[model samples]
Target: MTLAAGSLCLGGIVLFVVLAAGALLAFDEPGTANDGATFDAYVWRVARFTLLQASLSTALSIIFAIPVTRALARQLSFPGRVWVLRLMALPLGLPALVAALGLIGIWGRQGVLNSGLAWLGLAQPVSIYGLSGILIAHVFFNMPLAARLMLGGLERIPGEYWLVGTNLGMRPWSIFRFIEWPAICGLLPGIAGLIFMLCATSFTLVLTLGGGPAASTIEVAIYQALRFDFDPPRAIALSMLQITVTAVLLISIRMLTPKADEGHGSGRMVRRFDGRRGLGRAGDGLVIAIAVVFLVLPLASVVSSGLRSDLTKLVTDPLVQRAFLTSLVIAVVSGLFCVVATAAMIQARQTALASRHPTKPLRGLASGISASTSLVLLVPPVVLGAGWFLLLRPFGDVALFAPLLVILINMLMAMPFVYRVLEPAIATHSARTGRLAASLGLGGWNRLRFIDWPGLRKPFMMALSFACALSLGDLGAVALFGSQDMVTLPWLLYSRMGSYRSTDAAGLALFLGLICLMLTIAGTPAADRNDKRKPDAA
Candidate 1:
């Protein structure tokens, strides 16, 4: 059953990419006998420019991340350190539209930076429009993520490794090179590929900051063709090109993903002075300060702007009320759906693997199931929305199914993160309990309740909470399929921001941030909670 579900998921993903691309590719006349001559030079030029910019953006973002990660590893728990690490997660949850708005609020002509410069009697110089602005925002968003990923790798190096280093008199740089780097090197390719993929597909930031046609990404170009020109062929062509790139990069990501190491264990990593006392402390301080300023200041701008807005609007706006209702229903329903699916997956694994599986077929099935769990990352929001829409349109009213659709897509979106969070505890529980249960003639719920659940309660609750938070902040499929009646808070905020209602957008951003922060806190416990985490990651 698990194998079959895995196959279905893979088939669904492949068909969506292929059909979407093929439909768009067919817009061209294949028999233009002068085929080479018939190729549009303008499209070729745009595609080239798109690839070039994405490549540059990815390179710069990852490069800056090194210093940011270095600082975070040592200084995650200073006065405001926990807040800084928490702030880093905002961009991942940020809707592209809101992020663009925040970017403009600080860097646009009338923005804080310009206004502040004028106050300083300096030239109002350096435009936040075009290539430079997009690059900076991408770095702003990505550096923290890279740092966290790298920091996770460093932390897994058992405290014993640090002790051994201290005994051997290994210097800070030497310790990093010999012990830390080797462990983290495995994650670099995967992190870079993930960041590159995100940059390549970025639509809102590129559209908002790229100034004009000269700096747009392929993703924004696709949106323009579909929304502005009503040109299905061009949209399809662009989709095909994206599929080619995404497919390649995602395959590489899969090849490189580490073995499951949940624990959401990356909360506020202020492991002070694992290296040297004075030098390490200074280095950690500098890194933490830079990260906090970049990640938190824009957020402060949002909140400060929110304070200036008419607070009554949140209650008085009928649309806001309706969207709030829509979002709540969607979040609860989606969280339940994800919980059920995860439960099903865990149960299926237990059933099949209870016996010491030496059979090749069973082993292959388990591997495929694990890989299927990873598919959520490969399926982009728009692609999943488009596929399910086509598959279901003939039979039902998609508008009526808006919330359900949102829940379903969100389940997919939340998979890898959910799996990453739950897998470690699940693996430990399965390892310790399965053998004992089999020997004791324990089976079914009896074993689960008596042995497993007690051990896994923390990780399970943690997974559900984070998964819910993920669904709540999601803007992917919701943007494409959600009607005015089915609007989520993020989608509604995007609409307001899109229409230049910055004050309202800011207020909503602050509200949404609190809600998400609350959920994250409720769901995932910090590394301190799970002290026995096996200090090994693939």
Candidate 2:
């Protein structure tokens, strides 16, 4: 029964993608021209720009992260070290639109940077727009993630290696070359690929900061084709191009980066001699300080600018009220859907794993069901939205079904995350209690309430809250489907930015950021605590 349900959920995702792709293909030929630009030429330009930015963003993020990760790994006992690591996780939950606004407040024409430059009598002020701005925003969001992941790789290093290196009187560079470099290198391919995929499919950051056509990504181009130009053929072409690029990236990531065993280390600190004094210590401290400032300044700008806005008036506006409610409803509904689907998949996989004589096909089925959830990540939200737009347009007004499509896409997008959060808890619960529950003749709700729920409640809530936060901040699907009647907070915030309502946008950004932060805090405590308890072997 659980397998059937999981299969149904997977089937739904497949059906949606198939219908959308079929609709896109049915509507237009590939080489058709739109707005005097041949579809082929336009696609080539957009695809090239997309890959270029993604590659650059990945390179910059990884390059910046190496030093930060190394610094954190070396300086384990520094003041507020735990909080600094926690700070690195904050950007993951921060909405792209909110982060974009924060970046603008710091880097825009009348921003702090320009003001400072003027005070310093500098002739030229930096512009946070176009390729430069996209790279900055991507790096801001991705660098910390890379650092944290790389730090995990560093932490996984055994204590004996460090001991041997120290006994050999290895210099910093020598230790890095023989020890730290290999650990970091093993992680780089996977981290870089993940960052590249994110930047390639990035929609909100590019839409907000991509300046013009000269810097547009394929995802943004799809939005423009549908929303601005009303060119379905062009949107279809771009969507296909986006999918192709994503598939290639996914294939490359899989081929280049073999999976590593999940590490479970004893929680014990390993003493290290490197970077304990002299210029090495100072250099590590400097790197950490700069990273902290780079991260904190944008958030500070958001809060300061937001508090200065007319919040009472903005909150009172009916449009704002409606959008807020709409966003909450969508987020909650999507999160619930994700929870149900993820639970089914987890149950099926665990049941298969617990089988006494599992067949090859059964094992394959379980693996496939588990992998299917992540399949959504390969399809950009805009592509899904565009395909659905084509699929629904002929029936009636697409806007009428916008809310449903948005909810579905957001749910699918959140499923992988929800699954990751809930799977371990559920598996551990089953391992500990499954036999006892079976012997007691417990089944269904009785077993769940008596055994599973007690242990799984926190994890379940964490998954739900994280899923909700993700959906709440999503701008990609809504950008394609949003209308006067179907407005979401992200869509509303983007509209405000477009209209030059910086004060209102700032206020909205603050509200969204705070809500996301709360959800993230609730959802991440377990993982944060777990990380804090990790064995540091630097």
lDDT of each: 0.68, 0.88
Q: Would you estimate the TM-scores of all the predictions?
A: 0.79, 0.95
Residue-level lDDT for 496 in candidate 1: 81
| Clashes per candidate (backbone, < 3 Å) | 2, 0
lDDT of 1 at 437: 85
Q: Please, what are the lDDT tens digits per residue for candidate 1 over residues 73-173?
A: 65535565566666777677654555666667787787888889888988856677888888877887887788778877766656655566768878778
Candidate 1, overall lDDT?
A: 0.68
Q: After TM-score superposition, what is the CA distance of residue 189 in candidate 2 from its true location, in Å?
A: 0.7
Q: Give the per-residue lDDT digits (tens) of candidate 2, residues 277-367.
A: 9999999999999999999999999999999999999889999999999999999999999898889878987777677989997798788
Model 1 residue 282 lDDT score: 78
